[model samples]
Target: MSATQFFKISLKRSTIGLAPDYRAAARTLGLHRSHQTVYRPADSTTAGLILKLKELVKVENVASIPTSVEINAARKAARGYQVVEKQGAFTKI
Candidate 1:
């Protein structure tokens, strides 16, 4: 079987002050806030919506949808420092 693809759509801009149609399109795409992302199958309906809100969103073609754990990991910040050693327990002399 062929592998299915998905569209990684992210709201790069806010919809405030925009036309009602544009707002509706974003809402329909499950985007409620800026920087929020949603995955949808790569299809014509999704393409039309993306075209309508192309200026407000960023779209990328992904091979597959990511799991919640993977998504969270991608959003997590990296720790810059490494732990070289642990503190030893102190004893009274």
Candidate 2:
């Protein structure tokens, strides 16, 4: 399979007090909340939006799209121990 080049943008600031145009640009770019992230194809429209909201976001280049499962797995906390009593009923304390 081939990988597509895209921009991974994370909103670093809130747009509440910004100009309406600036906020619109951020909305168009799929960024509506601080710390929220979205991926866009590497193209002029995306570039223009990024430039328009440059001060409110952080950008990075990502080479491939990860599956939803992968994304979900990445966000899950790691378990420190294995469950060895799966077949047993819970014991009363």
Taking the tens digit of each residue's C-alpha lDDT, what string does model 1 give over 1-93?
A: 136588999999999999999999999999999999999988899999999999999999888888999988998999798888998999899
C-alpha RMSD by candidate, in order: 6.6, 6.8
Which 10-residue window of candidate 1 scores lowest in summed lDDT?
A: 1-10
Return the lDDT, model 1, position 37: 90
Which ranges of candidate 1 are over 4 A from the true structure? 1-4, 77-93
lDDT of 2: 0.89
CA lDDT scores, all candidates in order:
0.93, 0.89
Please provide TM-scores, in order, for all candidate models, with all chains considered together: 0.77, 0.77
What lDDT is obtained when candidate 1 is compared to the true structure?
0.93
Pairs of residues at least 3 apart in sequence or in different chains that clash in candidate 1:
none
TM-score of 1: 0.77
